[model samples]
Target: MARFFVSSDHIEYDDAGCAKNVLIKGTDVRHIKDVLRMSVGDTVTLCDSCGNEYVCSISDICNDFITTSVISAARCGSEPRIAIVLCQGIAKGEKMDFIIQKNVELGLNEIIPVLTEHTVVKFANAKDAEKKQIRWQRISEEAAKQCGRGVVPIVGMPDSYKNVIDRITSDDDTSTTLYIMPYENETDRTLKTVLYENKDFLNEGGSIKRICVFIGPEGGFSKKETEYAVSKGFTTVTLGKRILRTETAGMATVAAIRYEIGD
Candidate 1:
């Protein structure tokens, strides 16, 4: 069965708040009617972006929308219990795209492209940044669909490293947010060590609800940048002895976190 994401408004709910039907509109209409060649009575899965999924059988297909009767609905099992956000330093060329795609597959909740001291790519203007954000979002959506993710991870606009640090550190509920930054120089603290030390938070019913992983660009974070982030409550940890690329660091960190948390 094919799976597609829809907004809450696209789902029709019964009096008891159970989903009864779903309306598939926009480009997906064409994909279903033409590309996939799906017809009435075909089964498809629909997610409402709120961690709920519906199994439906198509009842009608028209020019602009496809209507389906809900067969079943349940909480999405694929979503991780703990939300993970990747604050990655934007890489050059197509590396950023690859980063977004793999992180989505690993169950990341969101991504924020960070502009650091060593970041090589610079946006011409606000317009250029907007275009890149839009493209990154599309890549996130496609990856979500491909990996059976119930909710598409959001690709945030590029933000300065200091701003990101400030925003994350200023959270009112600091107890629930875990911030980890991977630096090559942080040899004493390994990711596994930190995770094991924080096992209580990673366990069920723990205070931690979100994890943020920060990765540096090609040339990596400057000493000043690393120290600033560390002062702002970000725990600096080494991924391993080997230095990983900007693209690989986020993915590896996420995977390791997921495995440790049993997500």
Candidate 2:
């Protein structure tokens, strides 16, 4: 069965009756009726974006939306216990797009486009940045749908490195928190070393709840910037001996963390 995400408001209850309804609006109507050719009685899964999945069967297809009766509902189990937020340095062209798509598939919780010291991409204005953010967010939603993700990961507005540091540290608890920045300049400290050493955070059979990974743009973070991040409690580490592209670094770190922390 095909799966889709719907806002909680799209769900309605029949007060006088017992049959709850799942209504799908907007472009999904066309997808169900025209593209998928799914008719009344066809089954589909609808997510409420709150980690809940509804098994619904189409009962009516109207001009504006598709209405279905809920067959059953269950909490979504595809989401990882850990929430990994990717603080990606905004790269030029479609690099951010690829980054968002792949990271969503890899179970990232959210993405923040950061303006690092060496970031080359600059928006024309606020309007331009807003448009780009919208586009990237849509890419995340699409990727989530394809990968059976229960909730679409949000692509947050681009922020400066300093702003990101402040936002991350504001609510972080030192004892359990893990904030990492993968840098090319760092050689002695490796990602594996840090993850393995932090066994306290990842206790036996206990999953990590919060992790933040930072990846620089093409030119990478400047020495002054790296030092500033390190000062802000971010553990600067390397992926390995070889260098990886800006886009690859985030995904690699996400996968490694998932493996080390037990996805």
Candidate 3:
């Protein structure tokens, strides 16, 4: 069935206090009626974007949009077991878009773009930053839907390397049990070692709830940048002996985390 996101206010019901109708508006309406050619009595799924999925039957069709009467409300299909926030150094071209989309599919909870010392491409002004942010946000939303994510992952405004350090440390020190930064020079330190060193992280609970992964850009983080991260209490780990590309590093880290944590 087709799927679309709706607001809580759009949920209407019958005397039984069950959701029976939902009215779609704006572009959603146009997409449904004009694009999809869905007719009255057709079935579709309207989600609240807050993890609730309502199975609905189309009740009416109009020039503006279509209305659907809810059949049932249930949990969305794909929600990860744990939360992971990826703080990635911004890469050039559409690479960032590809990362955000795949990472969301891989069940990332948040994405933060960081400006590292070796970043090749830079946004010149505020206008450019705002535009890029908007684009990233749209990509996040589309990717969420495409992967049937319960909640949309945020593509936050880009931050400087320094600002990322300050915010994470100041915000909630206990939020992440392991703040990992994979370095090319850290040959002796492997992902397995990092997980083993922090095995106690899973002791308090049956599982660890959060982790912060720091990834570098094309030329990678400078020595000063890595030093700054270490100064902020981030544990430097190596993915392996081989140097990974900017795109490969973050995804590899995420996969390793999922495998180790059963997430």
Q: Write the per-residue lDDT of candidate 3 for residues 96-210, one digit (tens) a residue.
A: 9998988888889899999999988799997898789889988887787777776778888998999987887677545554688999988777887887777767444634667
Q: Record all residue pairs in model 3 with backbone atoms less than 3 Å apart, i.e. clashing.
A: 20-69, 20-70
Candidate topping TM-score: 1
Clashes of 2: 0
Q: All models: lDDT? A: 0.94, 0.89, 0.83
Candidate No. with top lDDT: 1
Error of 1 at 135 (Å): 1.0
Q: What is the full ranking by TM-score, best candidate first?
A: 1, 2, 3
Per-model TM-score, in order, reads 0.97, 0.93, 0.89
Cα lDDT for residue 230, candidate 2: 88
Q: State the lDDT of candidate 2 residue by residue for 1-263, as single tens digits.
A: 79899998888877864338988998888988889999999999999889999899999999998899999888999999878999999998998999999999999999999998899998889899899999999999889989999999999998888998888877745445688999998989999999888866676554456788989999999998889888888999988889999999999999998888778
